[model samples]
Target chain A: MRAIFPAYLLALIIALAPTSVLATDDVEGAYRLGGGYALGDTGLRLGGYASTEIDVPRTAPWHFSLSDLSLFLTWDNGSRLHFFSELEAGDLLSAGEDESLGVQNVHFEFERCYLDTLVNNNLTVRVGKFLSPIGQWNIIHAAPLVWTTSRPVATENLFSTHATGLMLHGSVNVAQHLLEYSVYGDASETFEAHRSNNPFENAFGAHVRYYLTDSLQLGATYANFVLNDLQPIRYNLAGLDLAWSYQRYELSSEIVYRTTHHTTVENTWQGFIQGVAPISQQWFVIGRYEYFGQTQADAGQIGLLGLAYRPLPPVILKLEYRLGEHNEVLAPDGLSASFAILF
Target chain B: MRLRLVYPMLLILCLAGFPAWAAEPLAVVTAPDYPLSSLSLDDLKLIYLRKSQMDAEGKRWIPLNLPATDPLRRDFSRALFSLLPEEQEEYWNIQYFNGISPPKVMASEEAILRFVASTNGAIGYVRKQKVDPRVKVLLLITPFPPN
Candidate 1:
């Protein structure tokens, strides 16, 4: 199954290529810069993004790699039903600083596949696999949309990044303010598990976000899950996050803590605060600080400063330097650069 | 002498108001039979931003947009969101990644009028003077004063 997935994806892309070309002639002005190509009047659209990164570590071998190549398909019935899916192939090729280059064994996985049914103006029911709505970063983590090349540790480690099952999500307006909520659960294993993923067996969680003002939002999340580890430990997790923007400057932060029911020594927690300030219309300066700790491992802290340039909305170039103490594998101390484009 | 002075003053006043009079007012239009007769400014904002998909009646609202470079589009965006279409690029980028696309873009106001008139639940904006009986006008927007 794992080996055939890529072949299937290749065939799908090949089949869609001619349709996309025909769509350009059938639909007037069907293509936009970042937006996908509409498949005639059928309501289906095809789009994707790609990114490459150069990693230079202080004590490790430097390398350059094709980090992510992702494709997505979306269909809207123009009424009550909508469908979306994303397939990603990561680390397709790599070259070491020692003048060696080769095609790396790639990991192909379905990042998101779901159907959304509109129940009303204030509610939507979604079934299948979707990004866990725990915080803002996880859902919009695409390379072209984010400010930095590296993700915060807390956002990736504290909970299941993807949930396979069902979710009920909605938003309502109250006195000119917006309130959004989601409740989701997954009882079975992931549909197509990737070796790098930390899949979970059973989990349920809820998230709520309130827009205090047009530029400020606060969110809270809670979840309980059994990690698919060798011993299958059960854990409870909680988190809080904030996002605020004034003009072109922005600030965001999230903190997550997890506790195991079987052992006190295995509890873990992490937090981070990131800020982006616009230097000009297309240039930005970013700074972030993070701290991660586990009961059984050395606690670590890291700080990063980066600059990003967006020549266009869907194209970005980033360079950053990282410094840290008691660093873990995820938070390496180094300099990294990346270029990404969404089409 | 008094008559001459009054004539000059009147001429200056007319000249000062010429731009405002020549500026075309925009109208939010939809199918003649679209359920709602009017939409609040807040609702319009939400709909265009893709924050609100369905209306109070549980029917979807398909919003249409003019090309970003169109003068009418610039005026409409400024009047509706207080931002130019170019300024909202970042917002649209994030929305695109989340599988929520911005309103479909039409080539011209004529295309918008034709689409909105024939399609149910369709909504678009066009010049008030160009509005015909084929579409129903929901809201009228006057261009903001230039800075």
Candidate 2:
């Protein structure tokens, strides 16, 4: 299996590395060797994050994978301009799949690499490939950062997750309320599909967000693009996302609808609501419910329950169970647990 | 007789554990030449989180923090952010993923004080006792009981 080699390598590294590297003094910062370190006072930084996961579905065997290994290169410039770049190797190694599933031995990609120019306190310009600022999860989808092992279907299925072009983003305070917006357009297929996760081409999108306070946020997104899967199809999608958090509890939800310009195909709408409550400083529980509706297809509902534990700041352990109705063929009921880390 | 003596000694130990302690106040200070003389709690929170980069005057603002485990830093974060250690960790992880890093961390209050006092537009927090006239106090956070 593809996961065999990476499993051995990971085991060997863990066995050989010094435990003192994770000493108390160095734990806040990344482990000294693989940690995020500033390059002197030059404003440049080097850091990386990696995560491996294991999953078991009702219909499939246990799946073990080296999910993501990424490196970050950033420059603050200490001025109005900044540079950020990320190189990712996803599905770097998988223990349970063949080449037919698009799971390669070492799949390298440029997840996001961009340049940002701040015009002022209220306006900025960004150029290059960046994550599409759609739903909340689209921007913070890293495994270790999210609470559960499974991502909501709407976050991925409704629109392209990445855009390659220029964007204008800004935020301003209006009567003590924060108003934020971003507009982006793609002139051509700038990113190679194989080297990047570019699902669409010739796209234009806009996102507007209003923050009543630090705890609450509401946003809307709209995009039009030509799908890149096999035959090119024109599609328009719109979404709304909401997030609110109190001391120990948080709620997030997103709704998306998409349709093709040509009228024969069915339009689809999907949404999911998820809540998380911290049981203690190191542990939390989560519940999520989701629904999808199609014009001429069977509608479906899904429910998930999850528990997460953080042994350290950069490490997370998660266990999740899912139940689905009317979408059993697409997403089988399953239980998955994973260990993820960020550094 | 042995049991009675033991009970008296235990009572003495319990009394010793409940001594009254004074809560330390924290001063958020900036360089003498810095534009602002005082700041709101909202502005302070935004600055320390690296969400805002400039003062109202459009001048750059550099925020500094003490090492994570420092008692003073812990107290300041608790009173201001109302976040636990694990929550703080999660917050930092999200920021890192979004291309933002936490403020520069100094080893001790003296280092933070020195940095803020010497650098223009720099800000840091220290115990009220450590604050000197070299830096301007922008805000004072009254200590809350540690959780």
List TM-scores for all candidates, in order: 0.89, 0.83
Docking class of 1: acceptable
Q: After superposition, how far is residue A126 of candidate 1 from its true place, in Å?
A: 1.0
Candidate 2 residue-wise lDDT, B1-147, digit = tens: 899999999999988987666787899999888877789987788777776776667656777877777888888888777764445766788878767777767778788877777776678899998888888888999977854
lDDT of each: 0.82, 0.76
Off by over 4 Å in 2: A1-35, A97-103, A191-195, A294-297, A328-330, B1-24, B84-86, B145-147
Please provide, for model 2 over A18-111, each residue's C-alpha lDDT reduced to its tens digit, 9 standing for 90 to 100. Answer: 3211111112343332237766555557777888777788777777787899988766635666677778988887776432434566777777
Tens digits of per-residue lDDT, candidate 1, B1-147, equal: 899999999999998887554567899999898888998888888889888898877778878988888889898898887888988988998888878888878878888888888777778999998999999998888878655
Clashes of 1: 0
Residue A28 in model 1: lDDT? 40
After superposing candidate 1 on the true structure, give the runs of residues whose Cα lies further than 4 Å from its correct spot.
A1-28, A97-99, A190-196, A264-266, B1-24
Clashing pairs in 1: none
